[model samples]
Target: MRCGLVLVALLTLPVAAGRADEADDAFAKKLGAIVRDPRQSLWARVEAANMIGKIGPNAGAAAGDLIAVIERLRPTEQEPLQEAIVEALGQLGAPAKAALPAFTRLAGRTIDLDLALKQSRDAILNSSDSQEIDALARQLLSRDPSSRVRATKALSDLGPVARNAAPFLAIALGDADADVRRGAINAINRVTPNAKPTEAFVRAIAVDLRDPDANYRLLAVRALGRLGAPASIAVADIDALRSDPDPDVRRAVVDALNRIPIPQLPPGVTATNP
Candidate 1:
């Protein structure tokens, strides 16, 4: 039995090691840098994206970098590179969900582009692998804010499957860095839209409505709104922000209030809304 187990382990070791080697962030970052370097040949950039895609889940951190390249090339007549980037995002699967919004904007432009976008979206939603999700969740607690931001972006793309990372994201909502805080709320909205909003979670996000940065407040309100009826717990707080000093924040607050529906409470249980 021991010899048979040893044989099986040896058989699997190479394949596992190969994937681990590809997951190296340094390698993925180098490919991302190549994809973004304008001076590089067009084919070189396309190849770089293709390489990153081939790296699979571990290369998820490069999704934002690839999206930046896509945005820069979308207007130009670089159809081939655009297609390659889109294909790479599809290959990245669930980790590339962050690209769906960008693909939505690029839709209606052409048949090929639309089809590619649909395929990528399907791939992202159909992905069942938990390994990538686990890796990004660990990155959520990284000491570096940039790493946390990338993890949040990737986790947000995961839909309900990222529910386990909610606690980390909640803590991130209070991060000292505005960008990290913004990313955290964005992640919460996308990652746990249907999750039962706990008092602590709801309160953690509600605190953001009073954040010093107007943009953070606006994003927090939008995140809460995205929670739909589940976020009714924050309705009173959001309503109070209707007269916020920042016009955009106030506008978002009103829109959020509109989005949150009246929750059905038990008999004798009062509604949380004011």
Candidate 2:
């Protein structure tokens, strides 16, 4: 009786696994249809992408469908969908490799897709932690805005241990995209705020003081304040913003100035504050 029970259990295992695979494939197929349907609402398509990612590699059948959806969209209509698709592709890991070329082409169409693309490729290759960090650092410097945004965010999530990416992040401070610049500052604050601020970094933050966006100016001042003494080079620049048109910016400027230890500069040397 014991031998018979063991035989039965062994026989059921493959059948059960097969059923599970079939079910996963069915679900993936349904979700892929939703993703491919133009009539679907943006949120619906995004939710479908999320579901495919949640299913992981078993939903590999949907990889080609997801790529098709991305390739079909015009740039004007892609912003909301592409990010979600890129994220989903990353989650699919090895099965999504065929989509790599699509990711590359999409990256050229926008600045936000590169980081996600790199992440997807990493997933396909199953990169190690160190490799991921190295890849992200390289992506941080990518001219693709989306790539830089994703890279900064990934580094920020890694916390202070990712301080090595800080130098690359400094370059992002002057990025054309405000979100990328903001992400860089936020990452810097997390990764190396306690370390001595770099001269180039201070100059970059100082430039933000004159940004047309009031909120970005506020964020820049707040980051400088957090750096305290290291950010003294930007003291004069912060002081100039004391009379900014925006009241909130004026208040943050005051707080930042108080935190930053102002230094006296020599007459012959001009402060590179801005």
Best by lDDT: 2
lDDT at 231, model 2:
88
| Deviation (Å) of 266 in candidate 2 | 6.7
Q: Which parts of model 1 are misplaced by more than 4 Å?
A: 1-23, 128-274
Score each candidate by Cα lDDT. 0.74, 0.77
Model 2 residue 153 distance off true place after TM-score fit, in angstroms = 0.7
The 10-residue segment of model 2 with minimum total lDDT is 7-16
lDDT of 2 by residue, 134-246 (tens): 78999988879899899989989887778777778888888878778778877887888586667877777777888898987898898788878988888877888877999
How do all models score by TM-score? 0.41, 0.47
Please count the clashing residue pairs in each candidate, in the order shown. 0, 4
The digit string of per-residue lDDT tens for model 1 on 77-96 reads: 67777877888888888878
Q: Please report how far candidate 1 places residue 177 from its true position, in Å.
A: 36
Query: For candidate 1, which ten residues in a row score worst on lDDT?
Result: 6-15
Top TM-score hit? 2
